[model samples]
Target: MPTLVKRLLAALVIFLLLVVINQYMSKEGLFGFGVPSYYARLIVLAGINIILAVSLNLITGFTGQFSIGHAGFMAVGAYSSAYLTVYYAQAWERSLGGIVGGSLAHALIFLLAILVGAIVAALAGLIVGIPSLRLRGDYLAIVTLGFAEIIRIVILNIDSVGGATGFTVPGYANFLWVYAFAIITIVIVYNIVHSDAGRALVSIREDELAAEAMGINTTRYKVLAFVISSALAGMAGVLAGHYLSFLSTNDFQFIRSFEIIIMIVLGGMGSLTGAILGAIIITFLPELLRTLGPRLESLLSSIFGADNIPASVHTFLLQLANYRLVIFAALLILIMLTRPQGILGTREFGLSWLKRARRRPEGDKPVGTGGVSIAEQEPPSAIDRAKEVKNQ
Candidate 1:
């Protein structure tokens, strides 16, 4: 079949699959045990993580910049979006009274919040990227880490926006909003990566000095990558904040930044598909572990006798709920030490490889009207060619 036709068919199949899954969840529940709401939340979280990972991969993986303050940008977005939603929702409620209380107004407010969040985050990215990107490697990482902490502290002090006490946001984050943002994020990143600007970014990643020597403004591309990545991270934060319907300073912290970095690293940095896969796996793995924790505890109690089990064992098992960070850190260390190129490395999965593999099975054929094969008919050694020319 033609490539275009194949692509269209694949897209249609994906769309149908998504629709079927949505219908199934609506009817039979997402977890298959009648708890569709929880599964829906999980899917939303996975989408947000995928956005975070893929966007950050553009900077850390493609541009070779160590950004540790992505969560700060996310915090900026979340607080900005939350403030807009709460403030506007209240104003709309007061102005329109009962007319604006339904799903339509809520949907409008949610969109407004997303826009506000993205703009706020992009502005924050500009501020942070300008000064912090002047440094490189560990210095850049340290600056970003400090920036994130500063954002958290600032959020904590803002009383009007709930200050230290978290504020409740309207629960307008449904499957539609989450998946839409995720799709937009993915599409934007995909386009950017395939553009000339993306090539410049990759060149800078390969060698900043060389890129500069080639007349490429390395600083400009770096800042551009940072801004785009930060904006996407902010979008993810908005979705997450609205989904939870609550916002706290703790939600956007250094640890959150590290978690995003882990997703990018595990996914293979520059690979977009790897980013999505990594995000889904990382986001769902903790939930899976939580489910297993109880069974493991029960088995241990049966083996060791429930009465003899120490209280600390329960505490230890409970700690596993938060121990995802530990696992993430260990996995990162292992990757860095062994396979720093990541799971998929820098190569993208494409159909051209399959075509090339198929061609390889055909082997060599004889040249037309000659005993020589195609390979043998090629130019001889440079010196021999030169000697033949001289002799002729």
Candidate 2:
């Protein structure tokens, strides 16, 4: 089959899957079965985090630039799009709803909002990248981090969007929209990584000075990666803001930026699949740990008999659960010590691994077979090739 047809089929399948998932996530059951709201919400948020992580990977991972201001771009997207939807979306939706169906109108408006958020975030990235990107190592990190805090502080004082209190906007995003964009972000980053520009970006990461010496225009590519990363982050923010139906400066705190950094680092800085895995782990790990206390208590009670278990022991177990963050930190430290390169270490998870597994070892083939043995197959030496060339 043609690649285009395959892509279209894949797209259709993904759309249908998302639709089924959205229905299951809704209050009303899909075919009498539905996921609990809590799980559904977690999945949606995880998708958003995936976008943020993968985009950050492009700049910091593939392009070799350290950036901690992703949350700032996210804030820019959230508030700017929120400002649009709050003040203008209704009128435009009503006007367009009459011409097109209500559903289409709402989607159109939200898409416009997403575009606005992305563009504005890209502009913010450009503004920040131009000056700060010139700096390298810890200085660049400090500048990006400072810029993120500055954006957060500035947003805190803007009363139009409710300032410190927060801003509420229409709920126009759901599982389908969020995941669709998440997939788009992944595809974008993947293509960019595999393309000529991706090669240039990787070159810059490997050695910026060497890339510049080769006339690769290091600064332009760095800024491009930064802008693209920022824009995708903004899009994630738009989805997040619209899905949550609220925007808060508190959500875009410096810690949030750090969390994004942690996702990429924990996953493997240069790996796309690693970023995604990291995002999922980061988003769900804390919640998963929430059950540890009760489970541990139950296990101890079963072993010692409930009557024999001391109140103090139970108290300690509960308290330990509360200290899960400390545990989480320890786990991260352990991972870093054992596998500092990260879970994947710049490798992707795919069918290629299977192909590698199927390959035969060199010299393993029988000599009697029609195929030439690896040990017997040889190329002409360099000297022989040079003599032949001279003779020719």
Would you give me the overall lDDT of model 2? 0.93
TM-score of 1: 0.78
Number of the top TM-score candidate? 2
Per-residue alpha-carbon lDDT of model 1 for 21-91, expressed as tens digits? 65555546556644367777788789889889888988998899999999999989888988888877667
- Which residue runs of candidate 1 sit more than 4 Å off their true CA positions? 1-20, 26-36, 90-104, 293-338, 349-392
Cα deviation of 178 in candidate 2 (Å)?
Answer: 1.0
Candidate 2 worst ten-residue window by lDDT: 365-374
**Cα distance off (Å), candidate 1, residue 114:** 0.7
TM-scores for candidates 1 onward, in order: 0.78, 0.90
lDDT measured at residue 58 in model 2 versus the true structure, 0 to 100:
98
lDDT of 2 by residue, 1-392 (tens): 99999999999999899888888888896999998999999999999999999999999999999888999999999999999999999999999999998999999999999999999999999999999998998999999999999989999998998898999999999999999999999999999999999999999999999999999988899999999999999999999999999888889988999999899899999999999999999999888787788888899888989888889988887887688898888888999999899899898988775664566776665674358755676877999899999999
lDDT of 1: 0.82
What's the lDDT for all of these models? 0.82, 0.93
